[model samples]
Target: MLAEGPLEEAVEGLDVEIEWKPFELRAEPKATLRPEDPYLPEIWKRAVYPMARRLGVDITLPTVSPQPYTRLAFEGWQFAVEHGLGDAYNHRMFRAFFQESLDLGRLDVLVGLAEEIGLDGPAYRKALEDGTYYERHQDALRDAEAHRVQAVPTILVGDTRLEGVPSTAQLRKAVLDERARLAASVTVEGVVCRADGTGCA
Candidate 1:
């Protein structure tokens, strides 16, 4: 939530394509944290809510205890992407979890969210039920591991990587810097020389 606003402003009218990837905070067999847990509330109070308030994004600590594992939800994401509704699916998922307190770990809930975004509900449900996208989702997880993603909202612009929620100015600067680097490389390669090769030096 905190990253969304700043990210939107930073990439506005820029030739940037945002790709949302899977990063499960509590991947299976690992237990999901409960709001009753001191760690959950402590971090939310200290960091999340303050950042949300500053960014003017509406987000809350979900009350779902023993929160659901996200493997199934990410599988649904693969389905959504195949149908060209990937971005919408991601936005709805975030709203469902953080805002509506909906359980994403449930197949029925996932189908409902998919249907809400005009995806074929039955097809999505069948895909999840039969584990059709399971391997695909696993492949995505492996990609994330290869990237060594240690935090959420990790933005990579050229060689500049911003972990956690970055300010709009910081994100904008990284993007501009990357663009400048690409432009410089292009300029060097595009230099013209005389046919005689006298100006090649």
Candidate 2:
């Protein structure tokens, strides 16, 4: 939620393409955290709230107990990507979780969110039931593992990795540096006798 807004601002008008990859902190079989747990509230008060305030973002630690496993949500993301609604789906997912406290783990809730984003509700529900995007989601997870992504908000600019929550200034600088690196690496070949030859260089 926090990273999305700053990321948009950072890449505005820049020759950059942003891809939001999936990384599950607690993928299946593993127990998820509960908002009622002391650890959650403590971390929120100590770090999350402070960071949100610094970034001028209104965020809250959700009250959902045994937080919903996100595999279903990510699978829905795969469906959204195929339908050209990836960005909208991502934003809505964040809002539904943090602001609206919607259960992303529920099929009905996910289908409703998909409909809200202009996707065919029944088609999406059927896809989820049939596990249409299950493998695709798994592929994305493997890609994240290959990249050694161990945390959320792992922003990569060129080969540089920015972990955790990053300020807009930090993102902008990384983008500019990456652009400069790409520009420097591009080599142009000079043509000889270009004026006399129809085919040259």
Candidate 3:
């Protein structure tokens, strides 16, 4: 939901298969946050709120950070993805977390969002209660570690790794350039990096 606008446009009419791998930012398994967590203010002041404003995103960060690991929400996301409602689920969750100041780290909050997104709420509740997708969520966390993803909006086209949010034009160019490079490498048989993949770094 964060970079959906540009990313969706970037891959438009392209034969790119995007894989959404979720990851956690918390260092520990059970991480809780307070209103005065010290780091939150810095991130909001220096990065998040500014980026949101620049992107014209509607977000209202919480005064008191929720206590509980985000893995619970990620597990619910696993459920949403499996049910083919990942997009709606993700967007609503974003709105809930930021705009509505909902605690996504809470199972009840996640269940409510799932229901709002037309998913089976009770089943999702049970899944969270029983820890059904904990390991699956952990797998995604492992994949994030493998990719060295310390930030959100970490996009990869072929071998090009794009970190942070890129503008619609910038993302579109990246997608087009990558498409051209792949096509040219196969068709032209001479130019390997015609689109300056190095610049994408």
Number of the top lDDT candidate: 2
Sliding window of 10 residues with minimal summed lDDT for model 3: 192-201
The regions of model 1 sitting more than 4 angstroms off are 187-201
Task: List TM-scores for all candidates, in order.
Answer: 0.90, 0.91, 0.81
lDDT of 1 by residue, 89-184 (tens): 999999999999998988899999999999999999999999999999889888878888878878788789889999999999999988876654
Itemize residue pairs with steric clashes in candidate 3.
none
lDDT, model 1, position 75 = 92
Whole-model lDDT, model 2: 0.88
Please report the candidate that would top TM-score against the real structure.
Answer: 2
Q: Once superposed on the true structure, which residue ranges of model 2 sit more than 4 Å away at CA? A: 187-201
Give candidates' CA RMSD values in order: 4.4, 5.5, 5.0
C-alpha lDDT (0 to 100) for residue 150 of candidate 2: 91
The better-scoring model by lDDT among 1 and 3 is: 1
Off by over 4 Å in 3: 13-15, 30-33, 185-201
Clashing pairs in 1: none
